[model samples]
Target: MNNVALITGASRGIGHHLARHFYDLGYTLILIARHAPALEAFAATRDPARITTLAVDLSNTATAEPLLRQVLSDHARIDVLVNAAGIFRPGSTQTPVDDFSTLLATNVTAIHLLCQLCTPWLLKSAQGRIFNLASISGVQPFGSIASYAASKHALVGYSRSIARELGAQGIKVTTLCPDVVNTDMAEGSGLAADEMLSTEDICRAVDFVMSLSPAAIVEQLTIGRQPRPRQPR
Candidate 1:
């Protein structure tokens, strides 16, 4: 049976690269994101039998389970789940409470909810591992992207607690805290202008997380920033 690694936010960025990485490693994929056309296009470039996709907005209650259950029905087990779907709304999140709520809904809330729903299937995989795309922003205060940062911060805390809870189930949860990745997420931000992490680097962390022995559980792995180059000698 082909192990299915379900990757959310698969249309772009680290999710996109990770999807390719797993596909090359002979794992079937269930790629999910909000852009159906983009996903269809992306999957076209991969092995047809091993790749499937769902363009779903996790914020919609009706969409999440229907899509996940569909994938579950076809694949006997979910070997891995990478909760990489996130939003970066960088502006004055001034007075709109709904905006903040939506930010949390997409980033923190959806990741938590997906874990809850996928528990049984993941446990059935037995060797399964879960990875959440956390950020260094979680550990430090971000200047302008307050809501986005706070949501990611909450995700790290939530992931820690869940990792403890799921340890007995043979499930490993890893929170990837990479400082300033050079993805669409980093573009336009001050962090982008400075040296940043690469999607390939993050994808490697995901691969490493999945490669661990059943007994080995990595609670948290932080990929630190590169040292700045000297300006003047």
Candidate 2:
């Protein structure tokens, strides 16, 4: 049987790319995203039998949780889980309370709930792997994106703690903390495409993580771009 991979944020960005990668590798996919058109379009190009697309807004866990449960009911096991659905709110300490709440809801709470819900099914797989896409902000505080940073920090902390707990049960949990990637999110943050890491760089990190043996687990993989050289005056 083909291993099952449940990937959130499947409409675009890193998640979308990874979904394509896994699909090409013969893994059954359960793709979740907020936009149905993109998901449907992607699904249309592939074998419909192997793909399941769910358009869900992760910021609303109450609505998304049950929908996820219903979808997982038909799948026998989940071999790979990529929690890549996230939202960014650019602001400092003076950021609106609502922005902070939304960031935490989508970036932290929703992933926590997903890890909880998928643990059982993951345990059933021979090579269960959970990949949580965090950000450089998770480790280093960035200016003007305080709420986003805080939420990622929370996610990083939670994922690390669970890595210890889940490792004992033979599940490998990897937290990917990549610097700005060339995605819509990064573009919206005023980062030029040249200044950010490519989606392929992030995907390479995942490739490395997935290649490791069962005995070896990658707790965290951080990928950053090299600084451009200073031009002489």
Q: What TM-score, over all chains together, does every model reach?
A: 0.92, 0.97
Q: Residue by residue across 1-233, what tens digits does model 1's lDDT show?
A: 88889899999988888888889889999899999998999878777899888888998756687777777688778889999998877644562678788888988889987898788889998587889988888778877878778788899999999999987778888899888888887777666445888888987887787677767888888898877879996
Segments of candidate 2 deviating more than 4 angstroms: 188-190
Candidate 1 segments whose C-alpha is farther than 4 A from its true place: 91-95, 191-194
Local error of candidate 1 at 66, Å? 2.3
Worst 10 residues of 1 by lDDT: 88-97
Where does candidate 2 have its weakest 10-residue lDDT segment? 184-193
The models' CA-based lDDT, in order, is: 0.84, 0.92
In model 1, state the lDDT of residue 71: 70
Q: Model 1's lDDT to the true fold?
A: 0.84
Clash count for each candidate, listed in order shown = 0, 0
**lDDT leader:** 2
What would the TM-score be for candidate 1 when compared with the true structure? 0.92
